[model samples]
Target chain A: MDTISDTLGRFGGVYLLPLALGAVAFILMGAPSSWVTLTIAGLAMGMMVFLMASGLSLVFGLMDVLNFGHSAFISFGAFVAASILAGLSGWLEGGWFLASAALALALLGSIAFGLAAGLFFETVIIRPVYRDHLRQILITMGALIVSEQLILAIWGGTPFTVARPTFLEGAWIIGDVSIEIYRVFAFVLGLSVFVGLMLLLNRTRIGLLIRAGVENREMVESLGFKINRLFIGVFMLGSALAALGGAMWAGYETLITPALGGEMMIVVFIVVIIGGLGSIEGTLLGAIIVGLTANYVGFLAPKLALASNMILMMAILMWRPSGLKPAVK
Target chain B: MNVLLSIRDMKTSIGQYHVLHGVTFDVREGGVFVLLGRNGAGKTTTLRSIMGLWQPSPASITFKGQNIAGMTTADIARLGIAYVPENMGIFGGLTVQENLILATTKGRFDQIRLRRIYELFPALEQFWSKQAWALSGGQKQMLAVARAIIEPRDLILVDEPTKGLAPSIVAAMGEAFREIALTTTILLVEQNFNFARSLGRDMAVIDDGHVVHRGTMADFAADSDLQGKLLGLSA
Candidate 1:
């Protein structure tokens, strides 16, 4: 058993699962252009999901806090960004540079608001329930409900339409396939965040400490580094990332409501679980699988689209109980 | 000799059960001080209380003349003390080098100190890049001690370093502890009588969360009746 596991673990590039699934879809559909379009869309959706789930995964891994109310940050970010963009409609209608700047400002506003909310949530709500999974789940879920209601009170029950910048609208034509420009942007941004996070975790001292803490927090503390402060920082960072994902997702859907984050909670949880609870690389792999499976299944059988993620998660868990690439400390 | 650490009536309770009841012992500077006890005799708890892993109150733990009874583990560690728990506390998923790197306060490796550690435990350098979990039992114990001494420390609290090890490894560990005692004060908890007697300059026998005996190791070793009465050893 050890030899088998060692061999399995030694295989480095384990991300080909999604590509293999895409190949299956391509063969079944027998339409190269349509397959290309769906694959890119799947990748874009995966990237957005990853932005939201990676934070939760890190928090859970490091602090062992199961934050059920992570969706609140997403909803807050979506509404905050949407509101800012709505106010900047004039600048968005101007030249490309002005529109791009306005979009950038909206993202900044959303992220800032998200950071504040995250700080509040972590200090006031999450701090008291550290290491208590049942309480954390109960309290965070309650907080989620209350925040959703607050969103309803502030934004009303109607869904707000989100407009993409003129420069980001329409699809880029490449041969027979045309990909949405917003999706391309989401992919690039998501990939950049992933790369940045990898560097931060692998190349930096804090990252080493965080990883060590996940393995043995008491030891890390005994080594003269306060793990609580690191945990608080992680909590805030996770919340900010969730919000950023929410803002991007709002633009992708072109619709925002109180349920924006709540609805994505299932997908976020599925991705995090499928990617092992704390492994960033695992989360990315899980997200891509979920995105690809959903799109491919949705195309093949629209009725199975919503259930595809659940089925995939169950199957992966059965194969690897700890998820793929369970983050090594 | 100056007293490096002095614990006075240290009391600690884990949840509703009181573990340490007025456990008091003084560790002198520049030698190994052994805390001996049978299983569930609160030797580990006493060491933990000193390291500030458990909250100790209505107790005074003075290290370098500063009361550290109520301090956090990190704060206590910053005062130049390191702890090696009974489990060795090795981050199994991390490489040997990474494990050692995490122990340093500056987050940068001190090449000179690291070289000293490597010279002390040559096996650490041999398995530097390997994951800690893959190491043998004796190697893991060495890694744990190596981690504690990664940075210059004034005092080290080691819990059962020779637990579950072969006799040869235990003898080697005793030799290492004696070498380390030349520069730093050590407070060790051990179940193995032979290993404990080899390096312990001062000894305290703890039973039921209280210190039952305290004296020089030479005096303690000379009394077989006291060892049988306090530690259930019929040497």
Candidate 2:
């Protein structure tokens, strides 16, 4: 018990920073007495990071492809979901079942949009740049510009709003803490997707094949595994997950715009770098750390949210060049 | 006898420096065919070209009598040719059991055959649950070989099996190869002359991206001078 207390004492301040910031946010934001609301908010953002970081880390870790245009997919997904919500101006909150159906449609629609976007990016832009780092950077940068322009042209620079279901709009109060329903729903949704992704990667045969691809892509191909198809599948999945995150962000902020994706992309990169590339578990840990850091730092100075991630990434890299997890196979 | 794999005048270039310069070989049905060469002699490149990991100079590569040159590696693999690379490439993160399961993609889970494989390398059974990265060099080689033979294939291309392995493990590996050769066709690339000689089927000595000598291993073993001139070492 003494040892436990000593250990806790050493690490106790670290934990309290986030809790204290959250407590302050609960009071200052005038979000009446539900600490759970802020907890759910943290969880939601953490999950959003999970969806983006997992794909970024996987591709960067396994394929050695530093996808500079990953944010373009996120922006594209948000625009797609927002457009759908815009189209559904009249029908979002009819009932729980219909609201759920709308959300599902948006989710799947965003996934399909992600797939098409990924396919075009990989086949047209990224394929020619394989194993060429400089060319990959140049081409993907061009892709990022082109995608950003496309989003601007289609959705414009203005933010778009999507309605929340009536069931998910209110708040639940528990003693000193009042929690928002949408944030709770978003947290559950994020965790469920994370768990599902883990199962897909760990428990399936294709997962083994994918892991093999991560370790040695050429060998996987040499072993009679279709490496091109694997690359496409990985690219598609990564984009879909990123888009899913974008969709969730659209719901949380109740507003979607092309700008948010580019903003979030920087944080995603920091998470991938700090958590270690190619490790699913590492990405999860990294996401939570970055989420909490942003929340904690944002409480003191809202602008530090951006700088803190960069500082954290630099610190982790200075201590360990290969990121938190060594990517050597 | 049916021809399992044939490479004719294949040339492969990686970034302006050509690796395979008009190299050619053939593997007839059911025997251990060896690709012998000194270091950097394009022996591994030849195997990779056949498996489509490298682009072969357009030529007739007929496996099971169908032209397969220039095909994708995975498609060629699905056509029943398994490649074991020079570095003993087993998925390091996966366990021996998981590795075997992943390799056996036809849904043919042969526990008895797997047990037989474990019997060949008892150390493997002992470390079945351990991640393959933690395995010793010999155990990794055994796992690589086991992964190759787990799924049924018409031809298996093994690159440098006995490299960097202990003597006892090499002996065990030799025995395993002998057992595999009883029912399967193998095309091997080896610098270990004695190990290649022990297989005693047929040998092709490659030098500087070309096959310099092709004959029965018995004849090559008998001729020490030819071995010295081609491989720079006689065993």
Candidate 3:
């Protein structure tokens, strides 16, 4: 057993899970083009999931706040961005520059709303319940319900049609493989965000505080830092990222509802849990694994689509109870 | 020497159970002031109260002529007081370099002080880039102390830093504390009689949560009877 684990540990252990899963799935479904399409689609979905999960993980890991309303940020971001895209419909139909600009504006609108809403949420809703997990869960869950109803009241309970810009509208067909341009864009954007997040966490002072803060907030406080102040910044950043993710997801589906966040919430949670709370690298790895598994399972056994992530989460937890890459305390 | 910190009737309670009951002592400026106590004698709680890690501050807890009781832990820390908890509470996920770097103001280290730390704990220099969790027990304790003295602070509250170390490591830690005391005063809560005797100048004995005795360490060390009675130690 030791030798098996030793061999696995040498070859990246849990980090190689996505590749391992993909390899197994490839043999199971023997068509290369189909595999390629599924792989791309899964990766794109994973990136969006990553954006949503990263912040929630940090907020929970650092502040010890179990914010169930985190998905509310995702929902609001989607609706706000969807509204912006609808308003910028003209720009989205023009040249690449105009289309990209419109997309950027929509994302920015989500970000702005996220920051504002995050601050308000943290101060009004989250501040009163720090360290009370039960209260945080209850309050944030309550806030999520209120947000859903607000979305329902404003946008109505109807499925809102999202406008995709012309630049991101079509797919590039390569022989038997048909890849959506938006999926590639999503993959690139998510990768960029991942790179940026890595740099921010590893190369900056704020990142240092954050990493240390996750391990022990009291220790951070003893080092002369008001960790609560840092918590506010982190909460805002997480909300912004979640909002950006929501905007991307809205575009990915090209249709959304008040229940968009509620539905995505479960997936976001699974990704975060699989990644380990408070670990960015873990979250990314988990997201990709989940993304790949969900897509593969969706194709192979349509019945297991909803249960795939739950199974993956359970298997990983049974192997490593602390998640794949927990922040060592 | 002048008193660096004065705690008058300070009390702390954790969730309906009071841990510190009117604990009072003075940590004078310079030298090691060891708070000698047996297990469960509220030594850790007193240090925590001074660090403001716990609430329920009583009458007064003053540091450097300023009343610091009821202040936030960060605010108290900013007043030039560093604490090394009983757990050697360093961030295990962070690199050794990152751990030391975080303790400094704006992550900028004073070259002279940084050199001093490297000289004191040469092992830390060797494992500069290693994550703190990877460090051995002695190394982690050293890193914790290194973090406290990374930048010059006026006072350091160390809670049982030598708790689980081998004698060799404890001796090395004692030597480090001796060197460190020359610049910054340390309020060391220790159960080790010999270790406390070797380094402490002023000392106090807390039984439950109150200081039962306060005097020069020389006097305390001379009285084996007092040591046996107060700390259950024989000469």
Q: Candidate 1: TM-score? A: 0.96
Candidate 3: give the clashing pairs: none
lDDT of 1: 0.89
- Chain A TM-scores, candidates in order: 0.96, 0.86, 0.98
Q: What TM-score is obtained for chain B in each of the predicted models?
A: 0.97, 0.95, 0.97
Candidate 1 docking category? Answer: medium
Find the 10 residues in a row with the least total lDDT in model 3 chain A: A320-329
Highest TM-score against the true fold, candidate: 3
Q: Model 3: how far is A85 from its true place, Å? A: 0.6
Supply candidate 1's per-residue lDDT for B128.
94
lDDT string, candidate 3, A140-231, tens digits? 99999999999999999889999988878789999999999999999999999999989999999999999999998889999999988999
Per-candidate DockQ vs. reference: 0.71, 0.49, 0.84
Q: Residue pairs in steric clash, candidate 2?
A: A33-A176, A33-A177, A33-A178, A34-A177, A34-A178, A35-A177
- Model 1 residue B102 CA deviation (Å) reads 2.0
Error of 1 at B148 (Å): 1.1
